[model samples]
Target: MKPFWIYYQKEMLEASRTYKWIWVPAVFLLLGIMQPVSTYYLPEILTMSGEVPPEAAALFTIPSADSVMASTLSQFSTIGLLVLVLAGMNTVAGERATGTAELVLTRTVSTLPMMGAKWAAMMTLMLVSFALGLAGAAYYTHQLIGPLEWGAVASGGLLYAVWLAWIVTLVLPLGAVLRGPAAAFISLGTAAALSLLSGLLPSRFQWSPGRLSSMAAEWMLGAGAGAWAPVIAALLIMLLSIIAAAGLLRRSPLSPQS
Candidate 1:
């Protein structure tokens, strides 16, 4: 347990030194705030660009508050997720590739605690970044657009965060076995494929974690998210990711790719 905290602190310090703690949240806040601002000024923006006629500009309608907030979340679903995944892609792979893992494994009593600490640090960063981004988005949406149901925003944010955590968790195991960029690409690719499949087969893939993104938008829009299956499925996947990574780290501390 003590080792876990020690390792966790090291991971966080590294992130801080790298300015991840600053820029990541800042990016999320920017993404969130931009949604409502851009939507609210769409006509002005179009007019300034001179790409649209006055008649066409007049036809543009500002989305409702809830719709804008939902769209803000959608921004996280794509670019936000990409940024996080790329940032986390080297968590484990870098250690192994640089021979840092060899030193840590020698000093630590075992791999489980070290790996658990790594996972916890990653989870903390993801949650904090997402929460900040969501808060920023929600605030701008309310001020620029309209009132939002606080309950819906909280619930929807949790649901969306879960989906994100699950995707980011892939970095641990994938980074353990693959090179850094390969892990990032494969993780994002897997997430995209799952999201696409869930969208195409909503009825058949009701329990898919990918559906959580859509369900989160529905929640933000004051819609019932139906079953808790997606949340449960996401949790299960996250647990599996930890187990898989821990097992892999235990078995192949020196040669992760093997």
Candidate 2:
């Protein structure tokens, strides 16, 4: 437990040193604010561009607040997910690349504790960034759009966070076996494929983590059904990823090729 906290603190400090603590959350907040703000100003924007006729501009109406919030989640699903994966892609691989993992292991801290700490730190960043972004989106949506149900907002955010979690967790095991960039690419590719499959066959892929984004949107819209299956599957996948990362690190603490 002590070792885990120590490593967790080290990971947090590393994030701070790298300025990830600043940029990641700032990007998320920007992305979140952009959605509602853009949606609110679409008619004016179109008018300024002179692309749409005056008649067409008059036909435009702001979407419902719930829809705007859901759209904000969609924005997070793409760019936000990429940002998180890139931020965490090197969590393990970078350590190995710099010989830091080997040095840390020499201190008698086993692979599991170290891996657990890395996972926890990455999650902490993800949660904090997401929360900030969601809050920003909600606040803007309320002021520029309409009131929101705080209960649905919280529930929807949790579901979206889980969706983000499993994808980010992919970096752990993938990074243990691949270079940082390659690991990030593969993690994103996997997410894309799953999301594509889930969209193409909603009935067949009901339990897929890919459904999490849409599920979150539906939940926010008050049309959500219970989706325990995908939640459970996501939890299982995260657990397996941690275990696989630990095993891979134990075998090769210095580098993937090693």
Candidate 3:
């Protein structure tokens, strides 16, 4: 247990030191900032470009600050999964490819603990990035319009974050199962396929994790608690995937070096 924390701490420190780490938060925040800014000013931007007719422009106007805020939250809520896919794609696979994973596993740490440490770090990074992005988007939304339902906005943000975490569970295991570019490409391709399938599936299948990316914002606007069902279900599935991956990983032998 103590060793797990040590490894977890090391991974966190390494993550903080990497410049590439900046891209995760920056990209998420940029999308977050863009959401509200675009929602608030889209009409004006379109008008400047003469894209909307005077008669049509009247219909396109924002009704209230809440809807604009909702629209902003919705925009990034769906798109934010890409952040998880990109960041998590290389997590375990990169380590395995470079022989670092073998080095770590050779220590007293068990396979479960080693995987847990990485999973914990990945989970923390994902949540923190999403939260910061949400706060930034909220502030921008408030500035563009007036005060918003902060409670609703915050809840929506959290729902989206959880949804993203669930998606990461799926990707992280694939990262652990495959190595290097093969793992990353496979995870990314799977993400795209799942997204496409989710879109075409029936409403009952909407409970799937893939749909959470699209449904989170709606969860906020409607019954905030209702979304928890799918979110929790997805989390459970993610945990199961991790457990299964760990079992597979524990049985596999590390590649021998001549």
| Overall lDDT per candidate, in order of appearance | 0.86, 0.93, 0.68
Two-way lDDT contest, 2 vs 3, winner: 2
Q: Between candidates 1 and 3, name the one with more favorable TM-score.
A: 1
Note the residue pairs that clash in candidate 2.
Answer: none
TM-score, structure 3 vs. true:
0.84
Compose the digit string of candidate 3's lDDT tens values, residues 1-258: 987798789778878887436877887788778877877777777778896786776678654665665566555544565666666766666665566766666665357776677778888888877787777777887888678777777776777777667667665567666754565566556656665787887465656666665565665455443565567777797778777666755655242331
lDDT (tens digit, per residue) of candidate 1 on 1-258: 898889999999999999989888888888888998899999999988997998899999999998888888899988899889988988888887887788778786677677778878888888888888888888888888789899999988988899899899988888778888999999989889999999998888989888888888998889965748888888888888878887887677765353
Per TM-score, what order, best first? 2, 1, 3
**Clash pairs detected, candidate 3:** none
**Residue pairs whose backbone atoms clash in candidate 1:** none
Q: How well does each candidate superpose onto the true structure, as a TM-score?
A: 0.95, 0.97, 0.84
- Model 2 misplaced stretches (Cα beyond 4 Å): 256-258
- Supply every candidate's count of residue pairs whose N, Cα or C atoms clash at under 3 angstroms: 0, 0, 0
Q: What is the lDDT of candidate 2?
A: 0.93
Residue-level lDDT of model 2, residues 1-258, one tens digit each, is 999999899999999999999999998999999999999999999999997999999999999998999999999988999999999999998888878787778886478888899999999999999999999999999999999998899999999999999999999999998889999999999999999999999999989998998899999998889889999999999999999999998888877454
